[model samples]
Target chain A: MTVDSRSEKTRPDRAAATRDRILDAAERLFAERGVLAVSNRQIGEAAGQGNNSVVGYHFGGRSELVLAILRRHAVAVEQLRTDLLTRVHPGSALHDWVGCLVRPLPAHLAELGDQSWHARFLAQASNEPTLRAVIRADAKASPSLRRAQEGMFRLLPAVPAEVRAERGEMSRLVVVHMCAEYERALQNGVAPPSRTWETAAARLVDAVVGLWLAPVTPAVLGPDAALRCRR
Target chain B: MTVDSRSEKTRPDRAAATRDRILDAAERLFAERGVLAVSNRQIGEAAGQGNNSVVGYHFGGRSELVLAILRRHAVAVEQLRTDLLTRVHPGSALHDWVGCLVRPLPAHLAELGDQSWHARFLAQASNEPTLRAVIRADAKASPSLRRAQEGMFRLLPAVPAEVRAERGEMSRLVVVHMCAEYERALQNGVAPPSRTWETAAARLVDAVVGLWLAPVTPAVLGPDAALRCRR
Candidate 1:
């Protein structure tokens, strides 16, 4: 398969290969360092193109490259998340819906075959306005995303739309933090704190689902619930 | 009062002033543009230093400078968060605790005046590893941070140590997102989507608090409670 090309003057296949190599290197380097710390020249070197202009020529600049990395990974993640949600049996329970939400990451990361640098990349990416906007725009158009949305709405039918939106947003933030924790663990030379990605995924899914499953009356929510739940 | 000095130069006062001026300009630029997009020379010029050496002289480099900005604001935020939490009447309700968490941003942002740039600076700062590490380490030693830890612990007494840690991290992420939303709104040359800052703060606070306060069941309190709680 050919990668898309816009900035390079080469054979279509060569241009595509060069572009993919640049993005691959850029994503990994950005995760290891950061978007700001890595440079166009470094990305070019890592991709083996031997041309500093490749990043600018193909992606226009670092910002645009970041946008490209974001869009590319978002498509992959978006599809995986969608596929998992769609595979849910027609009448899955909230717990099953929760499973569908959390279970896919490890599996997908495994499939990524060490190219899963995007997990760390995402921790930083979620904070970038340009990248976040691209991801959000694509998500808004995703049918699978709509299905996930319906899954949440179905799970929290009693909750108001505003509440649902808030919950959904919080859930997304929790995932971001979880990935950061995982990234941090990996960086520290610690085996993933999560035994199997599934276990870690389970914890995240359950914690979030527990947050919304609601028996919490406004008055008795905080320490009481936390302590009570722990005990 | 003098700002912090450069480690290299013996001119503590001049170095400190230059450092503060650099920080001032950096914070402003970060808020107006973003950490990823701005550069050291621009920061130097805006500070009226007219020298590229300022980045290396005062803060070691761009990344450290970002850390300085984060450390500076994190100190102030921790203090305000602490002060707000302490005055909680002996028997404040959960909502009161939630309020303690949310109300200070706008209040402190106002007090910050020119330094209000610190909020958006922090929003982007969370993504920078060197900066994130510095702020996190510094936060661990900050006295004002105690109230947040204890307050959240009080609020979620039933949660285990690990879960509490996760919740605390999530709470911080929520704050970052709130800061980002405000930054984005301003970036687009519009006021925040909420009718008022207070209204936005209230909704965001409620959403965060609501997640932690979710109800605990016998299932949640079982031998597998910790495991189940992840859901």
Candidate 2:
């Protein structure tokens, strides 16, 4: 190969390796420390970069860096969800659909083993005001996630749209926080409630299915009642 | 009174006021930023203290500062729960007991008005590895919370202990996060899913009742199944 072509081929390879290293360091630091607590300078130091500006150069800003971390795992998680969806059908039970919603993330974490920081990292990101919308929008963009939500909604036609939306948010919280807690437990050498990710996912599916299938209680008090009661 | 005695009494009043200021500043900063992200120096400056060591003098450490913030709200929350429990008899429905569990925090937040930071503060603390245990231990120490849990357990005679424990954690996550999200929405001028904290608590009660009452699905896979499946 010509000198120019050889250098061009190796340059992209080196850049990709550096990107991966930075991502790994950022994820672990963000997970261990709070997301907003850890600075880009710290991330660069952790990634073994001599230049403090390396994080900004690669990712532009914190929000972009968080999104890149999320998108890195999104592909594998989306594929897992899509794979699970293939087994689901129009007549499948609500439990099966809930499985599609809950399993993919934990399954991905399980593959990462004890050293994985994705769950905790996402948990931190979800609580940050600036980053929360980013995470939600990313989830909204997922075709497999959309399919899973649709599958669940189809199974519960009688549920009100608002209640469904509310329960959907609850399910997301439970899965993310529970997995984060489980990840912390494992890393701390403390016993987690469930023995493995599959079992933890199973427990989550049960509770989430219950959350979705639970009867909606109509608001007994008018909107003004709460205000009146407060006064 | 003697001049020395009068000065002694006034000094305590001044110290008490300083402590409250420090707590208020720390809570708001921690809520807006992540818990670990905000430092003692920032908290002192926000509280209008000229000396950075004031936080160290009053609260000692980050964990203690977090606990002090939690304790500040715990009294009002406990009182609210106690009053709610007075109306709840042993024969009261599970929903009533769930109300005791869910309503107190939201009710307390309602009393604090739009500017309250307790929910968001707790949400931030709960996600932090070091502070999470402090919050959990504080919750475990509450008499009213213990009563509410026992009341629910009485109604749920058939559920396994582990399942109950898992559901309790789920309940805590839902309450903390949903209220945090609602508070953020209200502050941002975005419409929340519920109109008021009272109404929000009502929605939470409905979902948590379902969570606690939901049937547990026993594990179909062995402990080794997850490990084996990975291969």
Candidate 3:
């Protein structure tokens, strides 16, 4: 009787552990050092793997490695959103949906405790237009995210298509960079006004909701069209 | 006569022309490639200088080069803000103050036209936590900016101090990134709904004003103070 002789070195659990180690190392390196500066070999060494090509073998290229890192956090963040979404009723106010959108990220980071690199990783990646696509793709998987976005748009006033698009960009930019700043402040022992994650999220939610619902000037909307837009 | 060798090379016109050329090349390269990724040699070559050390000799290092580029635009944008300030009254509405904050940026970009790299350059530098200090320093030199920020803060609602600081970060992030995205969209020939810079500025001003004035959630504002904080 021939037993399956696959090596223990290639065991499923071992491979999974290896992937996680590489991801953890890569994230730290990418966060502290700029993403473009740190390399696959450095990541392998950081992960304690003697093989230089382990990173490439597991994650392919820098972009895919980046995507993998994003996927790791995104899963947890999405789960948070899913859990948050269950608490949000269908007829909940815009803030409820906005909360679902905003809270999960900070909550997840807070749970990660100190020395968390996910926020900085996100900040660095999102700043680069090309790299931001990976994040967007990962985010698209979350049903809760899609629903929250839909909820916001459904409640949105008749903004010019351009204005809506631009504000959407602004909202995302705020979320991405603000968290990075908060994380930096925490690491540097600089106490910001919103001391806790809860308060920070609250501040963000208020500003973002206001940003979405802010009145467009009559001149830009055109007085007649602006009146039509109001209702 | 041994009278002033290299005098032609040291001419003010030659130096000014060289500085402008280097700035142009650095801005384009930094915008297309990241500020960190591009080397001084590459910038010097791009500027048509034969000596590799020309960039370093002319502008010190990457940080100084970046600062010089920022100073170039800050002067123009500050002038624009100062000019706009002359029209703003002591009791101008929040949107008016926000306008002073928003308009100078897009208006300057619009004038720089298709090949403008200033917005993207700002976005890239501002995203890097350390690099942002240079921008803050340049911004401090603008009396109009200080006045506009103070005006907005004075008009602000009963926000928690921490919330105020967090939102301030959000506003700067949004401004830096939104302009980069807008510039990209324009470059890619993506005709957004807001066709003109004028309309885009109007939209940005409205949203930013709303963001500043958005109500803080009572829960986060704490129970004892929620009532007092409420409008």
Task: List the TM values for chain B, per candidate.
Answer: 0.73, 0.92, 0.88
> What lDDT tens digits, residue by residue, belong to model 3 across residues B130-212?
67887787787888899888877877877766667667778777777777877877887884564656666667778888888
Better of 1 and 2 by DockQ: 2
Q: What lDDT score goes with residue A164 in model 3?
A: 76
Please compute and give the TM-score of the first chain of candidate 3 against the native first chain: 0.86
RMSD of each: 8.1, 2.5, 5.0
The DockQ value obtained for model 3 is 0.45
**Native-to-model Cα distance after best TM-score fit, residue B80 in candidate 1, in Å:** 3.2
lDDT of 3 by residue, A58-145 (tens): 9898889999898788778888888777776768888878878887888888778778888888887776677887777777777889
Model 3 bad stretches (over 4 Å): A1-10, A218-231, B2-10, B218-231
Ranking by DockQ: 2, 3, 1
Estimated TM-score for each candidate: 0.76, 0.95, 0.88
Identify the candidate with maximal DockQ. Answer: 2
Residue lDDT tens for model 1, A1-231: 776565345677787788898889998887766566677898889999877787899999656787787667666666677667755765877766765555455445545643368777766666666666655675577676677656765766486554466566667777765766665665566643334344456556666776566432232234343222111
lDDT (C-alpha) at residue B50 in model 3:
95
Q: Which scores greater on lDDT, model 2 or model 3?
A: 2
lDDT of 2 by residue, B158-224 (tens): 8766667778899999999999988877878785544677667877888898787777777657657
Quote model 2's TM-score: 0.95
Which ten contiguous residues of candidate 2 chain A have the minimum total lDDT?
A222-231
Docking class of 1: incorrect
The 10 consecutive residues of candidate 1 chain B with the worst lDDT sum are B216-225
